[model samples]
Target: LADDGSRLWLNYDLIKDAKQRESYAPFTKFIAVASDNQTLKIATEELQTGLLGLLGKKIVTVKTATTSGGIILNVNKNAPSSANISNEGYEIYTEKGNIIISSKSETGVLYGAFELLRAIQTGKSLAKLSITSSPKVKIRMLNHWDNANGTVERGYAGSSMWKWNELPHRVDPRYVLYARANASIGINATSINNVNASSRFLTAEYLEKIKAVADVLRPYGIKVFISVNFRSPRTLGGLKTSDPLDPEVRKWWNDKTKEIHQYIPDFGGYLVKANSEGEPGPQDYGRTHADGANMLAEAMRPFSGIVIWRAFVYNADPNGDRFKEGYAQFKPLDGTFDPKVIVQVKNGPIDFMPREPFHPMFGAFPKTTLGMEFQITQEYLGQSTHLTYLAPMFKECLDTDTYAKGQGSTVAKVIDGSLYNAQYSLMAGVANTGSDVNWCGHPFNQSNWYAFGRLAWDHTLSSEQIASEWIRMTLTQAKPTEQKISDMMLKSHPIYVSYTYPLGTSHMMGESHHYGPEPWLAKSARPDWTSVYYHRADSVGLGFDRTGKLSNALQLYSPEVQQKWGNPEQCPLDYLLWFHHVPWSKKLSTGRSLWDELCERYYDGVVQVGNLQKTWESLKADVDPEIFENVKGRLKIQEKEALWWRDACVLYFGEYSKMPIPKPLTPPQ
Candidate 1:
């Protein structure tokens, strides 16, 4: 993964262009800077490394630095002067024949410096450049969900990156490496433990270990948070009750937070998954989600820390669809949460499936803050083997019109606080990183991490634009190859959904691991965990009818939303089955019956995989063999799985549809 993803997008290779390099080269002849701080030292060293590689000539330190027609990295006098830069923001301007990369902080200068180098690599002319930007969201963070046992929850790769046994004393190189990777993508905050947390982390021993990692990440402008076990006071602190409003409980949290700050003053905060997923919560003591969040918020407020309360609640309810549970649970608590508490909602009502309708909470809660929680690890998608680019998946949800305020209530606007008029907003990605040599196991999986950061920074950036920039920076700067890969990436999510679960039919993946198709699986004791519970597939047709008659899940949305999605014709094609149950013979707008449409989609997925492989092959000349072969290999796996999906679905649904295979899609059997 490009040196195990240690360098990420900070790779500063020499310019492949003749003219731009010549223009930038003359400015590199002399270097003079007015500062001698450690951050400035890092900035200078970064320039040397990037310039040396890009220019193919090492730059000797000039006794004095100036902007007299030379590349200058100038920091504004009033810029944020500390170890932290806003984690990710920078400005680059080129005028008067001099390129000046400046920011309010040293790390900003570092980011700007790298951005300038990237512009050069992409062959963008540098004669005139002016840019100023910061992250669109206040918190562009990654939730590790990594356990102290070295195993990660929902981790597809081998194991977690944290080496708990040898921490605080022996800092592993992976700690620094992981920090660098996160910083490269502008991720500033990391919760170092699983949200389904254990109480062992609160021990002084483990806090010391986290402190070491925090120290390493400090310079990179990354802060560390912990997923505190809700029952920590009772389970570990020898307390009788864990009630949030209890004075003793409040005192316990205050002492705990202060102790944490003592070790790591810049600690991000706590992420609570209370009363959710069997984890102990305030509900156990008859307190509400807001009460639980506010309790933690009170503990963190003194330190300016924010508590990220997860809205991913679901019980083993036998009577109700799990999709409706989250909105039902949190919708009543609007305007109830403390300002320091941000509700973290998953991208989908269910889990992180390949394609999901936007969560209902986006435009619903106008009074309280909410955060988008995306799974970078492909839990429902094909883990590391599939070449599914998730940027498009993110875009589909972010770009959807929630229409809470009539229109233009985009999910992006909702999370950015503009729609809700809230004070703070957040975005979190369930991290996919691990101990694999390539970090994410599959080379292409890194794109999911990269895409999450790009979207977190600016949800306005189109998925295509993000993909294009990613391909150029991560693979090669060639336009043709970048466009080709971007095209493949753009079509990846839909193609996967078409082959895997089309027409909004979902929860059909293989039981347990959710690796492959198992649409017809029977129910376990917990209805929510079963595929049959979600799809409701039968002889009449496939899909859940959430209209007034059947599931009636549509009631959660606004009347306009109910009117739009309440009908099959008006509902988006992606969500057609999520709300309706049409006959197999029902004609889609494509002039094909539901059966034929399904067959077409299955075959279309197969064809798209071939097209994607061809697209990747077209870039072999420009992409390095190390990275090219990695993605090529994964694309082959995707091709095989696409066929598996097509075969399994056609075989299973052919029984219900009772339609002969189309001439173009004749099965081998």
Candidate 2:
């Protein structure tokens, strides 16, 4: 039978090995739950279904286990532990011949249930099962850019999963599947609409539609949030002006918030994208970003929600640097925001480039809670055609030392609230999901979504570990086949960076669509939108100079960071072009001229894509035919597009460098 890829990583077919099935048989006799809440009920049902498939035996459900050799779910408010488990943390151990999953809350028990299933699915020995885990960040979520009209922004998959026309009455079973997939991976919150929001969502008619979706997801412990239009007071309500300081505007928002809570009492708070990319904001009325965000925060104060104010704003200054705009706008307003507001900053200073340095705003806001926004949709990284695993990309930013407090102040510590002892912390990924039968478009793209959730729960996991686990459960469990696929997934992102944006170059994608390379593009509606604005290739050099002589953007980092990246010689080769503009003839630390190295990377990337294709072809006998052919077909497209990116960028920059392609690397025809 061919796999349609509908069942994401939760594949639980009967264990082929009789010995392995026997090892899991002892714990499959029954599942006991002490509480009967909705979350616990869902956990019990999930365990039962998973066990029945894995062990081929129906597990009995009971309030309490009267015998040994059964799995038990225990909720103890005062569980003694060393890991300092939070309300949503879980501890699973073997006690008295019974596998015990204990937590302080029902939601924790649900998380533990999934973890226990993961251990069994990954073929771990259960003889001495002892695992204690908790989420590093408090709020881990996915921000969907779906529109009310059933279209999605930057969505490579099919149309929106939500059927807005049939909503509020006939709910799709896919919503439950979506919730289960998210809950299994530790995602607890989601914003279900685009940041470029529609005001109709605030009306009573649409609140009913949102409530229906929320009710289905509530059992899985997933809270629903909305991306709100900043000018709702004027659009939704008949207010004269949408100023933050206006009394009528405040009243309008307060009332609307109250009405939304009535439909879904546990709604997660607003995700606002005001004054960014032509979106309306407080600046239109002569107010600061904090003034806009604080007003919304005040209204949500009566509830347990928060306001996620986006810091993705920038101006179209042909003379000024776009890299410095986001930090300059919100860094000064750090201490001014209300307690319920978290200033959400992207992983990089610029938009979601494949390879970018950590955003300067990460550790700059000491007095305010900062949230990390990562894009998993692959909008800038080949969309659905190429396979790009993003765990390494995420870790690159998370593990970088911000030097906010001292030498060890990594971005992970700042995001987890340990560096600043912050009141709240969150990590959100721009969702890649749609109505595709496979969930994500490419079979491999699902790994990026899975990686985001796993890292969001615990940032310390290595990319290799996540890849191996995903491969074992989602694909073949054969160690040899799994290792081959794992290697491909691990090297995908860097290989993509090599051809697309080698050596810290940024934003050379085609206009608007942002898919293929358009390195020769020189004109756009805004200067920053043009490819030349970022690459800045000229007779002398082939990169933008953000050094003191020009943009002075590197000064935003700490002095410790400045010392490392300030000098062109001392900076890492990966980031050399991002901070400094060197001559084409200049020698790099790699023992090659600057122009030669760039050609080498771009050529090497195309060769690497061919290697990936060969590896996938060798595993055709081990993988599902549907999935194998799907990935194989996409790999062909990847190789074709890799050539496109390599040729365009090399030829475009070669004109400025006035140098022939290196001897070993053939020049594009």
Candidate 3:
């Protein structure tokens, strides 16, 4: 129990320095109080919990300054610097025999508390400390696609954490622990239920349960949101139809929102996945997505809540490419959505594969509020069976330039609202959490959750910075060892993508389970879900023809974007095949034919997986036994999966590419 990952990064291990301990002991001995509230109480409790574990001595709070040497939570005092300090900003320092932690806001005070714990965990001396930090993003949320039955969609980490049957009266200890972990990382809101929602969650009975969960999270400053079934008026409220423009449906939503507020005052509005994946929406009644979204927006406007309408729409047309579905559905209705309704778009058009180009709609919808929805769960990235750190993947999407207005318009700016200067901006991760003893099913997968929160807090923060911090905090801190582990994590995503879904091709995983390759499965009702539709690899060429001459998908982007990606030689190799369908013999920038390049990429992926495995093997003694063994076991699975992907993909593509494996290769198909 002591070595298991139950504590996550909140682990405040003991500091081990004789002289430095003497320097830090004065500050770690006391909790200075200037106010009272559940929030403040929580801050004190966390400080107490973190200190006693780290210093092995209880921290005593004094009404004034008891001893001349006590750590002071001086939040009520004026902050030192107003320049970088927002309300959610804080700084740590020592002066006049009191270690001072001051901030403009209570949340900032809590953050300072967490940092102090982190400093102690990393065995840094508290003397002469001056650290200031504030989140860059306004809203950071976790989207749980968990159902009423306690099952999480795409959740490889067992069932959902929320025990639906035992809520309202019964509180899980893990809920409190979970809230603390999130608050430590500045995750302010949690979209708890599935976006593919059930009307039952909106019912009064469930509201009580949701409220119970909220109470556990309230002290940590985390608000809970529920995803409402769009047709709730017709199904749950006994209305004739759930039309967005209809008076009855509008009134039903307004009253229902009011009822929800009566239970949890800080209930954080709705996350609707409407008219997508066969779910009913305004489109079902010949109304626009904006109409459906705006109805909910208007209903929640009075309560200061916002609606997050999902852009993961799938088309009913059997012939249409699913890759174009979200753009097709939302682009026309861009400016139509109410100001309170923010459109939530996934990072890519298709489901969360190992690799995908940033969604075109991220730049396409300039007039609307766009929120990023990234999947933190390794749903198709070998589930919890593989070790894949996703910070670089996140950075890849965030750093991608959209050129919507011009060249400087990056996806990170668009998501944080700097691009459009919108009042509210959101970044959501489809949570990789569960009831596992260690939270995320695989121990290393916890890095994804940590990275998401860190990035969401500040889009400017480098993934490398977050990885270094997480590795030291979550694991060991020997410089060479930390660097070694960080290198593995930082490169894990590319290695995974190289081995799994390289060249921007996606959704080759098994049809229903999404476990592995099914490149030949082309008969699914939705073409996008089928691998044959995306790759189109055959006798003549490979890759989908997204050009204007083919699917006209290139028309969705601005002229600059079309120019950037339209040409075969100029496009990034990561997405080289996504926009073009090139012949087997076409010479690439790598001086290899398209088939040979495919062979190289697929083989490169497998080799990288082996590289990650080897990197871990070399660091066996530097990391904790439990954590190292945990990742080692998972990386082994990743290697096996990598080989499975390599062999299976090469064998299948050979039937199409018709090229023998390079002369040196053994399996000369």
Candidate 4:
């Protein structure tokens, strides 16, 4: 059978190496279940299926391990003193001539089962296996931007995967496969609708459809969350006002939440996007963001649910640094939210740019639990067409030293609740999945989804390590092929950034669709919507100036951050344009004028895209024919688009710098 990407990284192709298979066949004698629960049953079945595919063996399930050289799923009611793991954590090791997958909860056993399968799939030596793993963030989730109309906002793949028109009674088997994929990656929570929510989802009719989804996901240890409309009381319940302070509105939400719980007992929680980009919120009724979130939190208090309030809000003032707005609005309200409320801040202050400095809110809101929201969809990158691996981008922000609690404080620590010892920690990815056979449009795009879940589970894993594992499991297992593809995957993001957002120039993509380059864009519906508003390109220089002279955005970060990024000479070149407005002729640390360096990066970026094409073509012998052709075609488009970006940006900015495209850097014919 041809390799269609529908299976994702869970592909269980039989082990071709006889010696490698012999090593794993010992554990296939039987899979013993310590406890028989719904989740444990799923774990047992998955292990059986994986063993059958990988070892060509039929494994039997037993109540307990009566013999040796088998796998045991042990759930310790009172966890062993030496086992340091959360309720959803697992400690897998070889013990008593049996490999034990021990956990405090059944879901942990399920995760461990997948981990064991992954080790085999990735050709890891399990001879002396001793692995202990847990999710770093309490809630690692995927936030879908799908609508009830079956269209996804900013979605570049196919139509929405929900099939909302056929639900409640006619559940699609795809939901089961989806749940299995998410469970394999340790994503325990998912919101089924767009954060720009529809009030219809709150209606009884749509609740039935959502309940159907929750049912399919529940057994896999995945919980369902809803992106709720703030004004649902007025829009759906015919209330006079949906004000958070209004008793009638409060009662309506309480009743609605209770009704939802009746249909789906484990409904995870609510995700809200309010008072920004035309979304209605508490501000419409003279209430702060806290008031709106707390009201929802109060309704969820009776249930074991949460309220994830988005902090992506910003004013339309072109003069205001939108970078500082999220901090300005929520920083003062720190330590003021209900225990159930978690502020979900985007990875960057602005929208998901090609390259962005870490959001200032990371360390600023020390009193609150802040969840990281990363866009796995390539809205500002190249959408589904370009092969851009986002793991590096995610790692860039995570590994960044926020200096929140001194030098070693990273964004990873902040969102994992270790920095200030917050109660909850979350990391959500805006999903890129759709109705495409591959789920994501491009075959390689699956890596972004895989990378997000893995990092959310353990932020310490390096991007290269994740890429290597993904390549071995999903693509070719050939060592030479894997190394070559990993190199291209690691470099893909920087290459895209080089042509599009080098030196932190951002919001330059075509205005509405957000594809291709448009740095010359000077007008849009809103002043802040225009590329010129962000790029500030002129005869003097290019890039935004967030210094106090223009906007006091730097004050939002710790003094360490401010001091580091304040001086033009001291700032890293990657983030230089984000904070400084240097003269076009000013020589950078690279020993070249700003214009020259900019031109070099743009020109070289196109050349690198050509190199990516060459790399993929060389792997044609090692990869699936269908997948190779698919990637080859996309790389062709990428190179053409890279040229489009290079010429357009270089020429447009050259109009201001009055500089040539530098020697040895000529535009494509």
Q: Give the TM-score (vs. native) of candidate 1.
A: 0.94
lDDT string, candidate 2, 1-669, tens digits: 798889999877776788988988777788988777899999999898888877788998888989988899999987765567888999899888899999898889999999988888888877789998888999999999999999999998899998888999999999988998899989999999999999888888889999999999988889999999988999879798999999999999899889899999998999999999999999999999999999999899899889999999999988889999999998889799998899899999999998999999878889999999999999999999999999999999999999999988999998888899988899999999999999889888899999999999999999999999899879977789999999999999999999999888999899999999998888889989998899888999877788899999999999898888889988887888888888899999989999999999999999999999999999989999999999999999999999999998889899999999888874433
Show pairs that collide, candidate 1: 13-54, 14-53, 14-54, 32-64, 32-65, 33-65
Query: 173-252 in candidate 1: lDDT tens per residue?
Result: 87766765666566778998999998998999999999998998887778898999999999878899999999999999
Mind giving the per-residue lDDT tens digits that candidate 4 earns over 1-669?
779899898878787888989988776688999667999999999999888887888899999888898999988868765535788999889987788998888899999999999999999977789998878899999999999999999888899999999998899888988999999989999999999999989889999999999988998888999999998999889999999999999999999999999988988999999998999999999999999999999999989999999999999887788888898899889999998999999999999998898999998887889999999988988998998999999999999999989998999999999999889999999999999999999999999999999999999999999999899889867789999999999999999999888987889889799999998888888888988888888899987888888887888888999999988898988888988887899999998899999998998899889889988888888898889999999999998999899999999999999988778774543
Model 1 ranges with Cα > 4 A deviation = 1-6, 17-20, 30-33, 60-64, 77-88, 666-669
lDDT for model 2 comes to 0.91
lDDT of 4 at 302: 87
Candidate 4: list runs displaced more than 4 Å: 80-83, 666-669
* True lDDT of residue 469, candidate 4: 89
Evaluate model 3: give its TM-score: 0.95
TM-score of each: 0.94, 0.98, 0.95, 0.98
Residue 556 displacement (Å), model 2? 0.3
Q: List the residue pairs that clash in candidate 3.
A: 498-605, 499-605
Q: Tell how far residue 169 is off in model 2, in angstroms.
A: 0.5
C-alpha local distance difference test of each model: 0.80, 0.91, 0.83, 0.91
RMSD of each: 3.1, 1.5, 2.5, 1.5
